[model samples]
Target: MSGAHAPAVVFDAVTVRYADSPAPALRSASFVVEEGELAVVAGRTGAGKSTLLGAVNGTVPHFTGGHLSGRVTVAGLDTRTHRPRDLADVVGVVRQDPLAGFVTDTVEEELAYTLEQLAVAPTAMRRRVEEVLDVLGIADLRDAPLSDLSGGQQQRVAIGSVLTAGPRVLVLDEPTSALDPAGAEEVLATLSRLVHDLGLTVVVSEHRLERIVGLADHLLLVHDDGTVTDGEPAALLATAPLAPPVVHLGRWAGWDPLPLTVRAARREARDLRTALETSTPPPGPAVPAPPAAAPVLLEGLGISVRHGDVTAVDGIDLGLAGGEVVALMGRNGSGKSSLLWALHGTGPRSAGAVEVRAGDTTVDPSRESPAQRRRHVGLVPQSAGDLLYLATVDAECRQADHEARAPAGTARGHLDRLAPGIPGDRHPRDLSEGQRLALVVAVQLTAAPDVLLLDEPTRGLDYPAKEALTRLLRRLAEDGAAVLVATHDVEFAAGVADRAVVMAGGAVVADGRARDVLCDSPAFAPQVAKVLSPQRLLTVAEVRRAFAAPPSADGARDLGGAGGGAGGSAPYPVLGGRR
Candidate 1:
C-alpha cells in the first residue's frame, strides 16, 4: 500500500500451525500497517490473536517452534529470513506478562540490558537509557528494584526496556490488562504520544478494548475461524458483539456514531436521561442466601504480611460466607493479592489467624499441609501457569483427579465446563493466556474447596469468555462456595460481585453493596456508571431495565434489592463465627 516509503509491517498470506495441532492458529492473514500508524488487533481467547502479533516480530516460527508459511515483513525486513533477535533494531516485542520480560533487578539496569546486548557504545547507551527512562516517565524508578515496583510501574519499565533499543515498530500484547484505571491511562497516553511525536509504528493486542478503541487508527478483528476483518474502529464497533458499555449505550440510544469514550457518551446522555425520567426499573435478583448460622468458609483476624521493612498487608480482619461472592478492589500494590495469599496460606504470613471452617471441621492454614490446605481453600495465582506442571492437558487432569480424590473424569468434566474447546492432549504451556487460565481454574475447581480465590483471573479473556466466567462464578456462589476475586476489571466486578471491598495502603477503606461502592468511587467506576452519574447505576442491563419499565408521574426509578447504599457501616459482617 505504501507508494513511496515502505510500510512498517506486512503479513502476506501468512498461516501458522503449532506442532501436533488440529487447526492452524492463524490462516490466510494478510495486512499492511503503514509507517507511523497505530493498529490494534482484537479477538476472543484462543482465537489466534497472539499468534498474529508474534508473526510481526518474527517470534511465531522461530521462538515458538511452529510451522510457518507465506511471509511477514517489518520495516522492510522479511521476518521469515530474520529471527526476533536479528530484527531487534527494526521491531520491539513486549509480552502480555511484564514480569517474564525482565532480565535485570533494577529499572535502570533492565532498560540498559538490551543496549548492552546490542553492544552500543558506553556514552550512547547511557544517553539512550536516560532518554527512555524519562520518555516512559519512569525516571523516579530508575534505581528501584523491579520486584519493589507495582504492576503498572513494572509494565512501564518493560516498555522502556524495549524502547531503549530504538526499534521503529513496537508490538505489545495486552499491555494494560493488569493495571488499574489510572495506570492503564498512563500507559495508553505514553503509546499515543509515541505514535504522534516519535513516529513509532505500534501494533497492540488488548482485551480491554475501551482503553484503546479511541486511540487506534485501524482495527484488526481476528475471528474464531482464523480470519481477520480490518476496518475503522467506529464502523466495526457498530456491529461488534464484543463492544464496550459506551458503544452498547450508543446502539441503544440510536446515536449516529457510537461514543468510544465517556465524555462523548455524556454529551449524548441528555436525551436518554430525559427519556428515563419517569421510568421505574424492576427489582434486582434476591441474594440467594438469607442470614443464617452457616459455617464460615474463610476468615482472617489481625493478618499481616511483610517483606523486609515494608508492611504489605497490615493488621486486618475479613471473612467470607458460603454462597458469597466478594470483589477485592484497589490500586496496584494495595495488598489485595497479599491478603489473598495469606488467606490461602501459600505465601508468607507474619502474624494473623487464618482459618477455614467446613462442616464443623476447623483447619488453620498455617498449621495444615499443602494438600490439607488445598482441600479446604483453593487459590489460582496471578501466573496461572505456575499451578500447571504436567506435559499434556489430559495428564494434568488425571493427576488432579488423583490428588483431589475426585471421581474418574471429574477434573476433565469440570475443565470442559469451564473451557469447552481445549484439546485434552494439548500441552498446557502451548495454550493461549485465556485457555491456560481456564485449565488452572478447572484444576482448582476439581478439588471443590469450600472457598475459591482467584487473582486477576480475567487478564487475557475476551468479552464472551468473561461473560462465561461471570456465569460460572455465580453458579459456584449459588452452590455455597465462597468466591473472592482480586481484580482490576471494573466491568467484571459489576457483573459478578454482590459485595465490594476497597483496599488502600494495606487497609480496608470501603465495604458495601456492588452498586454503591462501584458507582460512588471515581477511579473504579465502570464506563456506564460515569455516563449515567448521579443515578447510581452500575451496568447497561440496569439502563435497559430502567428504560423498559412503566413510566410514573414523577418519572422516577428505584433499582434496589441487596444491602443499601455504599456509605454505611454494618460491623463488616463477620464470617466463620456467628450468622
Candidate 2:
C-alpha cells in the first residue's frame, strides 16, 4: 500500500484493428487511470472494451496481429516496447474469460506459477499466495483441482493469482459475468477493499452496473460508435445520457444529485411511499408462445453420462410438458449442462429414458443419433456463442433457416426482433459476447423446432436484454415449444419458468412451482431469494408493486408515479438483517 502516487495508465488515441477484421475494433480510444483508485469501464459488447484493455498491456497489436496507431503506457512502462511478460511487473490483467487464466492443475499451483515466472523467492511466493487467498476468501479451494472448482471460485483464483504478483494496477474485464450473485458480490467487495485499504489501482469492465459503479471513483462509457465518455462515477452513472436503469430512476426522481448505490436509492425512495393518485403500471402484454394444443413431453426415468471416468450426470427423472417453461437449476459442475446435452444426444448417455412426443410419435432421446435429434431438438449451449464461425450475422441466421426449410423471411423477422442494429454483412464471430448471444438465439428461433433447450441463455446480457430474452422465452413456451433452460441464474429461472428443478451432484433434488420451489424450499432457494423473503417475488418488478398504492393503504397522500420499487415494502429485511 506504500508507493509514490503514480499515474497507472494512459491511452493516447489508441485503436486496434486485426488482420482479419475490416475495421478497427476500437476507434481512437483514449483514457487514463491514476494509481490507487477504482476505474470502471463499460460498453455494449464489441464496442472496443476488449480492444482498449488489450492496448493497455500491449496485447493489442502483439497477440492480435492488428494495426496499432497510438501510444499506450502502463505504470511508466511504454507498452510498445514491452511484451506481456515484460509488463507483468507493472500491470496485472484478468481476462474476460476465466478459463483463459488456467495454467496449472491445482488452484494453488496456478497461483504459484506466476510468482515463479516472475522469479520471486519461494518463501515470498508462499507468503504472497497465502495473503491473496486470505484476502479473496478462497483459501479452502487452494488445494482443489482447478477444473473442479465452480466458475466463481476459478475467477477469484484468477484475480488472486495476478494480485499475488504485486503489480501496481489490476485490469479486469467482465469479472462477474459468469458468476452467481453471491460470488459476484464477494469479488467486488474484495476489489473495493483492495483499492481503499491495500492501495491497489483497480480497473474493471462489467455490465452489472448496479453493484460496481457505486464503488468506482471514475467511470468510462463506451458507445457503439466508439465514443468514450468519462467522468466522476456518480455523474456518469446517474446523470449521463446512457445512464443505467437505477441511475436514470435516481436522477429523474431528483434524488440527491446522483445516487450511485442501491442503499442510496433507498434514501431517495420517499416518493414511492405515497399512494399513487392516478398513474398505474403499464399492462404487461401476454408474451408470444406456441399453440395451446400440441406439446412436447420429456418424461424421464434414469440417465447417466461419463466423460472419461467422471460421471457428470447420474440417474435422474424429469418431465417437460408442451407449452411449459421449465428451468434446470444448479450451481457449477452440478450436471445441468450434461443433462441438456444428454437430451439432445450430444453427450454420452449411459442409460436413461427421455421420451419426446412430437404429434403422434414419441421419440426416445438417448436412442436417437445426433443428426436425428437435431431435426427435432433445438439446443443453445452454454458458451454457445463460442461456436459461431461465420462472416455475416445474416449468414448465421440463414444457416438455421436453411436447415429448418422455413420461409427465408422468418429469419429476417427474427433478426429484426433480436438485433435490428446489426449490419447484414457484419461478422458474427467478431461481435461481442452479448451481441453474439442475441444472434445465436435469433438463429435458433428461426429453426422452428418443437423442443428448445437454452443453456445459461442470460450470460452477457444487461438488465434490458435479460428482460427481452425472458419475454421471448415466455412467448416460445406459450406457442407449445417445450423449453428447458439450464442456468446458474436462479432468479431468472424463477421469473420465466412455471416449474423449477434443482440439480446437485448430478441429480434433481427439488422440483415444483417456481415460487414454492425457489422461495419456500430451504435447500433449493437462490441467494437473493433468502434476502428478499417475499412470497413469489421473482423479479424487481414484482417487488415494486407493493409500493404502488391506488387510494391509500393507511390514508397516506397519493403519489402518482415513482420509478422501480419506490412504493413497495420497506427495503430493509424483516429477518436476520439479511437485506
Candidate 3:
C-alpha cells in the first residue's frame, strides 16, 4: 500500500522529446509520490503533463515514439528497461481520452480483456470487476454497449477496467475531462475513495484544481517551457499567481490559514462576520439581491433531426435575453444540442417559431441565412478548434472579425485579454486545450453576439482554466450577452450561470435561477455542492464573500487573496447524493 508519506514512485533527471523534435516535452523532470497519497499534476494542455505521466508507466517512448533519458523508477523498479506491461504490477493508468485504451464493446468485456492478460483466474476477475464497478457505481453499466455510452460513462468503464488489475499506483490523465457534473462528482468521489480506502498511490493529471484540491496531498505545476514547481497543494496554489482564480481569490480574501473545502470556506466567512460586527452600521438599508432578467421570447420553431426515427429536438419555442446564462442539461442523444443549433440556425430545424428580439429587428432564426445568424449568435463547439484550420491564432481571429464585420483589430483586444503572451503567429490548435478554448472565445467575442452557446467548454481545462472560463462567461453576461452553455460541469454552471435549464427526452424539464435549479437538482449540482452551498460561487472571491472575513468599517471588500487548507473543521466529510 502507498500509505501516508510512504514513497512509492520516484523520477530522477527525466527528459523526453520525440525523435527529431527540436525541444523536449519534459526536461529534467523529477517528482515523487508517497504510498497512500493523492498527487495532482497540472499544466496547460500540451504542457507535457500527459508525457510526464506516460513516463511513469513506460509509455513515453514505448507508445508515443519519443526519445527518453534518465531513470523513471516506479514502486522500486526502473522503467528504462521495462515496457508498460512490465510495470503492470506497479501501475494502472486512465487517460484524458479513455477511448485510447478501449478495444472492446462492453464494459465487462473490456475489464475481462485486461484481467485475462494478467492471467488472473476467472473467478477472481469477476469478483475484482464487481468490487471496482461497485466502487464507481457503474455496476448497472457492466453489460451496456460501449458505443452507446456517453463520454463520462465511457471513462468510468475505462477506469474500472484498470482498477480491476489491482495495480499499486494509479495514474489518471484528465480522468474527469469527459464527465458531466454528476459523472464528475462520481469520478472524484471514487478517486478520493481509492486514496483513502484502498490506500493506493494515486497520481492524477488534470486542469481543474477545485475538484481534487481539497483531497490532494501533493501538487505539481508544469510550465510550458518544461519548468515545474512542486509542493503541498495549498502552499503551491497560494503562491502560484497565474494559478486558477479560486486559488487567487482564496489567498486575497484572507481565509484564515485558507481552506480548500466548502466547510472551511464557510468557517472563514463566519470569522469575517465576526469582524464585520466590529464595524459601524450603514446609514441606508442593506442592498437587495440582483434583479431577475426577462425570459427569452421565441416565436414559431421548426427543426429537423432524427436519432433513429425520433427527433432529438422537435419544433420548439426558445429565446435568450440579456443578463442570463442558461445550462441546457440532458442525457446524451437528447435534443439539447440540436435545439441550440436550431436557435443559431447552424442546423436546420424543420417547421416552427424561431424569433430573437435584439434591439430594433426581430431576428427570425427560421427565416435567417447561415451567415446572418452567425453575426447575431456565437458558438463554441465541443471540439472548439474544429473551425480553426488557419496558420496562426491572429489569423483565425482576424478572419472571424472580417466575417463579423467588426474592426479587423477587434479580435486582438479580445485575444490579448484571454492570453496575454500568445503571439499572432502561433497556431491556435497547436496550443493547449485551455489556450485553444481561450483563443476560440477571443475570436468569437470579436463578433459581439447577443447570444453565445458553448458545448462542454471545460472538457480539457484544469481548475484554473475552468475558473477563468466561468469568470469570462459571467463577464460576458454582465455585458448584456445571453450565454447558453451545454455542459456537464454543474459547478461551473453554478458559478457562472444566472439561470439553469435541464433538457430531457428533447424538451426543457425546468428553468430558474442557477442556485434554485442546481441546488434542487443533484444531477446538475456541482461536485463541490456536496459540501458547499448550491450557490457554489465559481471564484475564490465569491467563495470568500460567502465564507471569508467580514466587510470593513464602510463594508469595504478585502481583495488580497490569502491562506488555504483547513487548520480547523473537524473533517471534510464526504457527501452522497444522486443527480
Q: Which candidate is the best by lDDT?
A: 1
Between candidates 1 and 3, the one scoring higher on TM-score is: 1
Instruction: Please write out the lDDT profile of model 1 over residues 1-579, one tens digit for every residue.
Output: 332367898888888998877789888988888888889999877788888998888888898888989988887788777788888987888887788779889999999999999999999999999899878888888999998887778888888988999999999999999898888888899999899999999999998887888899988999877888888888998886667777877887778777888899999998776666556453333334435965578889998999789887999899898887899999998999999999988779989898899567778876877767777889988889888888999999998888888898988888788777677788888787777887888888888888999999888888767777777788898888999999999888887888888899988888777777888899989887898776667667677667656556666665544321111111111000000
Quote each prediction's TM-score.
0.91, 0.81, 0.77
Error of 1 at 219 (Å): 0.9
lDDT of 3 by residue, 152-219 (tens): 78877887888888888999988876665556666788888888998888889876666667889998
TM-score winner = 1
Span of ten consecutive residues with least summed lDDT in model 1: 570-579
Give residue 499's error in model 1 in angstroms: 0.8
Ranking by lDDT: 1, 2, 3
Quick one: how many clashes does candidate 2 have? 12
What's model 3's TM-score? Answer: 0.77
Judged by lDDT against the true structure, how good is candidate 3? 0.69
